[model samples]
Target: MPLPKAQTLFGYSPEAPELSKAEVSRRFDELMATIDSLPTRHVGASEVAQAFGEGRGIDFGARPGNAFEALTKALDGPDIAKAMSSDALASVTSALEALKAEQPDLMKDITPSSPIGTGLVAYDLEAPAKMLTPRPTPLRNRLPRKKGIGLSHQFKVISGFTGTATGGVANIHPGIGDTTQTNFAPSGASNALYYARGPKISYAGYDKTVAYSQFSVSDAVTWSAQYAGQGYQDVRQLSRTSLLYSSMLLEERMLLMGRGTSGRGFLGAVAAPTGVALTARTAAGSEVALSGFTTNVYVKVTSDAGDFGQSVLSTAANVGVTAGQVVDVTCVLPAGATGVRVYVSTGASDPGDASRWYAGRVGYNTFTLQGALPTSGVAASTITADTTAYTNGYDGILPICTGPDSGYVNRLNAVLSNTNPGSEWQTAFAALYDAVKADPDRTLLNGSDRKQLSDALKTNSSSNYRMTITQDQLTGVTLGDVVNTIINEVTGKGVAVEVHPWMPQGNAPIISDTLPLPDSEVSDVWSVFNVQDLLGVDWPVTQFAFESSSYWMGALLCYAPAWNGAITGIKKA
Candidate 1:
């Protein structure tokens, strides 16, 4: 059959000569008649039924060239010579006509389409800015973190030797024979003499203890919230960061204040008062009127010197008076005591109950009980009966240095209200360094205490001094907003002062990184022991939302407590 002319196929052509509409219609009809007169080609069932072989014998190259060619071959067979046969052409044309009927619904026309209008708000079209999370946890980040073994971390502390020395040397002699007499002494002797004993090697057995603590944090995110935050933020990651940080802040607090709910928290670095007591005197004067003194009640007071701790019960004062009678008990406050808690016995002489205690500061130390006596019970329990003692948490530096039996640190009483307050503070600081005979890594104090120290320095100085801060091409000058250091006269070294936000005001602790032990495996004297370090996990979503949690199981360990020292009872000038 002859091919249709270009002008007849396209109905019109730019380069072709103009032709009558009747001539073009006649050419198109002749092309259609020739195509329809072609012989029909049929695919046999045997050929279409052939299946692809498996294994190495399978020929992947036997696949049809493309989807269109494959469909055409399946319906008309692979004979290129008869590809345009009437039956084969009709089968392909029928399939194509069906596809064309659905083309308008499935395909989009881009020619007539325009960009979206500008009437929408800018906020809706633009992406959001990045979010910010600021975490201010200094002690937790600064203290060294380490991994521990078993349920608890154990270590041995060697205090001193218990061996005794033999002053004078002894003489020894062997049995004398006929010809020669044996003598082991500076002077020769005939009689047999002997020193009775072996060498004595004795030393103190090391004290060993275990440290352990654990805490956890959890959070949840709804499906809708997470899905809504898809492009704006990663809600899951943000939740994880927040949870982990929250856990760390708790750990930091525990490091400072160890007495958590049931004493299951980390042991703090500061020590609880062990043996300090206040002196008591009882008389009937006018400090405050007594209220519940129907019977004779025994009064005892305990002192809390800054972060040192609430001291043990003091000497009981027996006051005999009726209800509403004035009970004035003059008490002698300890050298460094800042606050006091007064406990009264329900009976004549039993102050063991923990329910009848009244809390008071130093100014409120006067006992003014003015209520009718309802119930009479024993005295309140001490810090030891409950689990408030330093058991779960390790004994921190402050405890090790200032503990009753520690004999390592020099405890100096500072009076900030003295006439020469600056000189007094300087003397106390110098005394502490002098006792230790070395400088500390850094001096930790509350922000209020730091201000007091700075004020003291300014008051002590001869004049308001200022240095000329000249800046040139190669020179630069830097100034501090506040005084951050003090000079230790003993060591002639500048003590670096750091403000601890959580530290209890009115006291400053000088901590040394170097342990007193000659051979220490730990690099830092103070370190956090982790049986299980920080771990985070996501729970399987039961509903449309998911929950995540994080855990940190550890305790603070102090290798050498004596190397660290603190100045207690610091009153801000």
Candidate 2:
């Protein structure tokens, strides 16, 4: 029966053999090596041939002759011939054609030359190596040796006042009577005695001395006179005068103190000068005495007596005073005294005794001296202008124009800087057109004017403006869209778009030994074309497929010799 089929003979079968572990392992290794060595273009063909060979002891070599013949015979063999009908043959032929057609154009340009046998080597073989020259020493030193110095200063001044006042007399006098009679005779001698001296005869004056003697004439007369005076005149008068004067003399003393102390202890507190003590005796048998008042007051004493002397005592009544209490003695500076001194007296009287007082304390006024003395090094100097130090340093430069001018200058500069040059005319025109389209401002430019403007911008020179045009023009298009557009535009021009996704920008990946079809290209094609249409024989194949095919073919060519090397035990060329 047609020489039993290989599967039927010697226990061989058409169904894939249940290979032993060792056999399977060996077969898999051989297949892998074969696959690795062949060109990618033959990958499908080789696979087909291998399936046939494994099933029917056929051999497919690197050259198509033996492999193709073996494959043809295996298909037509008595046991398998019926399987290889006209339809199967046609399908295989079509697949082969499709695979061949997918080969990249770049592959045809490659010309491998034998370096050992050919005399047409492009590189020089006997050229001597040139010795590298040493770099010359630097011409000048640029390191900084010393740093510069900077210093600043400032000053401040403060001044003001405090004082107190007390005690005056309340005087009273009798009212004048309407009667003018000097004397009157008495009915009783005792009553006459009360009117003795004839009612004091003269009514010219109500003097205390005159009225006293006339009142001693009788206790009844004296008592009546006192009652009449009770509701009469009341007057207040100063019983004692005390003055405290601070003049140029006192200020001079304070300034001297300040200069001696530096700024450390510039402030001083002065207590009131001495004054007489007031004592009162009560029925409780205890003595209540009032000594001098104590208050913490301050002043800015300076050499400028003009300003210092103008200082007056501030009111201290609100600070330290009681209802029954009184400032019996006022603080004063003696007329002949040279420096500042405090004096005191008793009973609101001026003692005129300069020795009765002493200087309790002295103070230096920092406020007055602050203005006169130079500022300390620690003070901060006010900055009035930008400096060169800011230009090269991390500190930002202070703009020359601050407040109002900054905004105006910035806007003006921006507008001026954006003006298109002649070379960037096209880019500028495109940008303006885009802007107008987005927000058509007829008031800004009429249709005719816009066209003219566009024409002018088209001739302008500016890379920045050109880039703007590109972005604006491509608005929402994806990378795939760009490829499609390029392909469409370049089609029918004999030159097809060589889209090498894995290629470096300048050197196309089409020439690479291993190129992969970009997902973007596949996605883009799928978007516009049906999968069935793409697989159809007549549909145009993509550049990505072509490049990937060429890459695989190149890889196969390079490794073909390696396969022979493995079979023959020779080193690959």
Candidate 3:
């Protein structure tokens, strides 16, 4: 079999020549007929598959050495191989056709007929970003936050003891033995001895009470379950819980407001001015109490008609009546069923015009009258009930300090008015430190900002009086800001200061509630934890409900009363 001869020029019959087109084509045909048989097209996928064998192991030592070696070496290097092997290349190549036939969908969108390129041009062409999410919360990067808190643990416990109990009431003794603190000695050998009993311990008992607060999230259970594995929850849910804590702080601050509704006491009233009372005339033997007299006010009495007036009963001083000021009045009414009248007056008694006088409302200290006064009938046109006695807000530290009695025995020197109230802190504190010094235990002076307080103690700049500021106090405070100072009286020579938020800004309180002091009756805010599980769940009972934590507390200012004294009512400059 000979190959077809190549035609030249006009396709005419040509003479044989060594380099002629017909002779060359004829020779090429003779050479091809003598060559071994070969396939017409390039190697197919099946042919490559055959070369790869069962293992598809590429080997340089196989038939077709250089071509196999080049393709196989590219297999060892990924970048080179990525460009070399593919579905389209496999169809046109022969030596390494087997390798390309086993090609993965590495070029995800590439195909046998597809044009290849580089970069994003050849990458996924639909969009540059991934599919958008519905409500994706970005990861939060911030400092960890701590929320609502209240008073210290000491306020919730008995002053001298520790540990939890259903109710821990500690009885503090005053150590004043021998029936009385005083002893009697006769001049002769016959001093009478009165020896009686063994249980001479005079104990003041202080008890504990509890407080609570609670809150619930809207879809808390559902949301928590949804975001169970997440590090943070929805912003709304976090706020709802934090609000519960805020409520706790609010209640706690009020409890610390010195006094409140009922006996929901904080610290005992230590700053009340004593002898600030509405008293009856001592000389007249005609004493009376007023209905609306909540605070000390002045009054004048007179005998307009001398109806039953034996003596003038008044608060005015008897003898030296200054031109404008009336310290006391001298008046009295006989004991009989007769009407009497009292009038509000800072001036001398006006005898002529009854219309000019305001009748004083009467109560408790009842006295008899011999005859009716001219202006005694009507409830109006005269004095009404006094308003100075009552108030809704807690009795601030001032009133608490002013009014102390037996059991809560703080030595009170009641005065009608502290004229020089500015220097009252020095006088009051000197008394307090002196009384507690004998106990051999330290004391704390707890209070908020008050007038002249800092100025009064500025001289004792040493350890005698220094401030222990809290983290909360550090905020919003500068050099001149009125601040509560916590002073530690460690050596029995100084006093401790605790600036509490709930303490009234006007009337300062001194206590050991925060920093610590010797056993003073007013130190503990007794909280009895009947059931203190603050965060408990109640499903159907409350609508997606969460309860605020709560507890019961009562101020226990009854232990070792003599150990505490407050110098209240100093004004600020």
- Separately for all candidates shown, the number of backbone clashes (residues 3 or more apart, or on different chains) is 10, 24, 56
Whose TM-score is greatest here? 1
Residue 239's C-alpha lDDT in candidate 2?
A: 7
Model 2 CA lDDT for position 258: 14
TM-score of each: 0.48, 0.10, 0.30
Question: For model 2, what is the alpha-carbon lDDT of residue 335?
Answer: 14
Error of 3 at 142 (Å): 29
Clashes of 1: 10
lDDT of 1 by residue, 1-573 (tens): 132243434344343345566755654455466556666756454444442323333233465543444444544543432534443244334544454454332222223231224433345545544547555667788888888877776777554333211112233343344455233443456665444433223344355455465667799999898899899877877788788887776666566545422244333222223333332233245434455443576666665534435656665666566544644434544433433556665555554556555533332233444444324443446444323334444444444444532223333334343344344335645654544333556777778777776655445544544434456688676643356666665666666788877666555667777643355564787788888988888899898887998877777776655456656655433
lDDT of each: 0.53, 0.22, 0.32
lDDT of 1: 0.53
lDDT of 2 by residue, 1-573 (tens): 022122222121234334345544443354345445544443566677766867643444343233334344444445433333343334333433343445333123223442234544475544333325332111001111121122111112111011101011222233335553333545444542322232331111111100000000101123334344443421110000000011112212221111111122211122222221222222122322233433311111111111112122222211232222332222232111112212222223322222122212111111110111121221111211212111111100011111111111111101111244221222222332232111110111112222333444444465543423223455664321111111111111111123221111111100111112232121110011111110101113342221100000000011000000000000011
Model 1 alpha-carbon drift over 4 Å, by segment: 1-134, 161-202, 224-234, 259-402, 405-438, 461-481, 516-522
- All candidates in order of TM-score, best leading: 1, 3, 2
